[model samples]
Target chain A: MIINGKLVVSSSPHIRSVESVQSVMTDVLIALFPAALMAVLLFGYRALITMIIAVLTAMLVEAVWLRKRDIFNDGSAAVTGLLLALILPAAVPWWVVVVGSASAIIIGKQVFGGIGYNIFNPALVGRVILVVSWGGHMAGDIWSTPHPFAFGFDVSTVTGATVLASPEKAVTFSLPEMFIGTIAGSMGETSALALLIGGIWLVYKGHIDYRIPGGFMATVFVLGVVFGGGFYGNHLMTGLFHLVAGGVMIAAIFMATDFVTTPVTPGGRLIFGIGCGLITMLIRLWGTLPEGVTFAILLMNALTPIIDNFTIPRQFGGVNNSA
Target chain B: MKAGNVYLQDLSRGIINENPVFRLLLGMCPVLGVTAFFINGLGMGIAATAVLIASNVVISALKNYIPSQVRIPCFIVVIATFVTIIEMVLQAFQPDLYEALGVFVPLIVVNCVILGRAEAFASKKPLLRSLVDGIAVGIGFTLALGILALVREVFGQGTILGPDPDSAIQLFGAGFEPMGLFGQPAGAFIALGLLLGVVNIIFKKFNIK
Candidate 1:
């Protein structure tokens, strides 16, 4: 076919931009870097080892699945691996990390036809699998005490329960400490500051929609204040604590905002985010699990298509609202 | 059909072409619910098969007498009668298995495979053909359960039979950590999905669809 007397290899509506998948993925990696760096700083060399294994395994699995020589194809696998590692405890065995990352690439992504076709975030899928398969290693009291700058020692030797794991101990840890990232929790999730910085970067670059995170955080804060029982402190303080604790910060910023699994429409995204928060708080307060971000986001992810369908924008002059 | 060919085809078709579990995807609840252990799944398969065969023979013989307008109710009554017999026998003899299978044994009455065979094959066919069809379909369902159970139990529980230390055979050493997912309901879905994918690829290759 010829377009304006010139042969064209592709179809129309091809608005070429500088943002190839490689560039977008590279940008995402950059956004995730501060959190990943903070994980290593907080958990030491163990976190670093876990991160490397996860990233490598994810990339390798993707490459093998696609039968491609390029292991760094688009770099989404790398992002998934790093994200998976962030939510996992520093004390998990090397094999668990390997298995988690491999399963993330296979069952989470590839099984759903890869990349954009998947409904749930691959990293969260891996985390849930690890959580269910090895609850003792993944959850329980495995949250390692952060040894900032002590990157050489074994982090697992000084294991303690996370603040979310024990509300009674929540009074001991200050909000500022949790804010600054030195807390007993999963590798990257402890550092609310680091995650916020990454999140701000992603938002500034126009990669993520602000409404989703805004809605998610707002809902969590509101629910925490209402139902959080003031066990650790005042209602407002408990709300603040819920916002910064466990996987809430990390999931609100990274996992829930995933472009593929999340709703595309603005209104739909807000609904999705709020739904995620509702489920998260419901589980945290009443459900058996200490944190419910993974299942919350996954459930919302399953509803994404429906959300998008319902939120289709009404036409300018249309009296009848088709949506 | 030739005399020998008719018998063989009627028997073999249900094993592959009209396999109750794999081909027809009938009776999914038990397939997903009870296949956590090999012994439980095999036991379920055997129990369901017994009821299926009995109902098929009965339904084929009674097809002429039963009115078409109320065929479904008649089928249920026949199927339920066999299920009760099987359920009582299991309870009296294999008490452990009866407990292991739990609600699933009685559920065999509503199992779509048995009812489906009765409605589609047994009601229209002669006694001998319906009986042969029942046997074939029963084998297929059992075989499917066995395969699914084998996969789930070996990887999920790391044992065969009942996960019993004395009786059950452990496939892996102590260091082996079974995927706990296989032990849960979600694992059943994933296992079934992956198996279905492989089966689909085979079907495509053989032009079976």
Candidate 2:
């Protein structure tokens, strides 16, 4: 074909989707609202403060780095900032929020040549740095106990360990309570029901592929049954508990399905999800840390390119003599 | 007039234009290994500088006599001799610094900056010019290590000149929490990468190259 008296030749993927970066990012923000609302409702006003600080700091840093006036218009930076805030403890100091948000924008995204060029999920990168830098605040017994429906409650009064941190105490809490937003953990990770609602919405909107989350949860369920002891009487119940525990729901559903950091091929997405599940279980079962979702997804993000390479389908009518 | 300017240029080039750590990226083992704290970086830099100067002067004086095919071995022998001398001197007098530096003091023999200068500069240049190059390169390496250590120590530990925990000067107050990762090996790479980027930007702004 010729255009403007010049030959126009391009690779496959000639039929492009109508979705823009802004539209996709906006859909992600919409999908995240339920979890964000649950976080504020569960943790009180401090959670809102943390989220605001994170999102604003991220946008400001991106704007400064890119020298663009309308940084928040793109919505990607806000999504990253909000996702990072969701995974952090509600009791985290204001400075930690500022530093973590700035690092997510500057070191994680901008340093890698910005947006689609980044290798890892920018939010996870910031969380990892925060975990490494301030393990005391990011993990361990720093989780604030949620006083659900009490928006006026002070966050400083009540503090408790996460379920993963104190499994002996956690065993007393019923499955329904865990599924609701009554557990002590990261702001958004406590409620499996809310996260599932958001995740399903994203899936319905075609913002995320189900195969990756499906493969991820399946691997986790199988491994949980194999590794997780029968704490709730039966192995199946224990596996379900593992599925609802920690950051598995949020990470598998939201983080692993990231468009840029995840594999492009359908087969590659399955492999990527399985890899994330295997690493997460390994860390939870044998590693020193209680939670493994962040590292697991980041490690899988690093392998995305290799997975894409192996899973690339042969061209139409291409030679298959090697097979 | 031109001769004096050339000599000055030789001294300044290594300090910025051809910085071994940031520019040439040589001797990364010691640079990354010992730059966790300010004092360790200073100790490593000074030790490497002493060895680099002695090796460069000796190699430049003996370059004509050494066979071209066996020049590398000759350079190693010369550099190793100076490193051993510096090692003994540090152990006898500065025992604390020697202990802090550990195996890195002896490992200076294989540092690319010393051997790199011997092969690339001293082997080709005259003795006086080679001596200037060695000193200039040594300063550059010291400056690079110092800058990295400063950033790492301040952010990682919230202190400066942290040779010993007792004598370290605390920059932050009691409420301040230091970023512990900055004090680890990973922090060294992050600090070095950011510093290298900033240095490159500054070099471009001023047309240093």
Clashes of 1: 0
Q: Could you give candidate 2's per-residue lDDT for residues A1-323 as a string of tens digits? A: 55578666899888988788898889899888989999999999999999999999999899988899997868899999999999999999989999999988888889999988999999999998899899888888898889998897778677789888766787887889889868899998988999999899999988888888998888888898988877766789878887898899999888999898999998999999999999998998889898899999999999999999988877789897644
B1-209, model 2: which lDDT tens digit per residue? 99888779998898988999989999988888888788989989999999999999999999999999999999999989999999999999989888888999999999989999999999999999999999999999999888898898899989898858787999998878999878778778877889989989998999987
Report residue A231 deviation for candidate 1 (angstroms). Answer: 2.7
Alpha-carbon shift of residue A164 in model 2 (angstroms): 0.8
What tens digits encode model 1's per-residue C-alpha lDDT throughout A133-205? 8788888688888988787879989898888978888889999999988889999899999999999999988
| Candidate 2 Cα deviation (angstroms), residue A126 | 0.7
DockQ of each: 0.69, 0.79
**What is candidate 1's CAPRI-style docking category based on DockQ?**
medium
Could you say which candidate leads in TM-score?
1
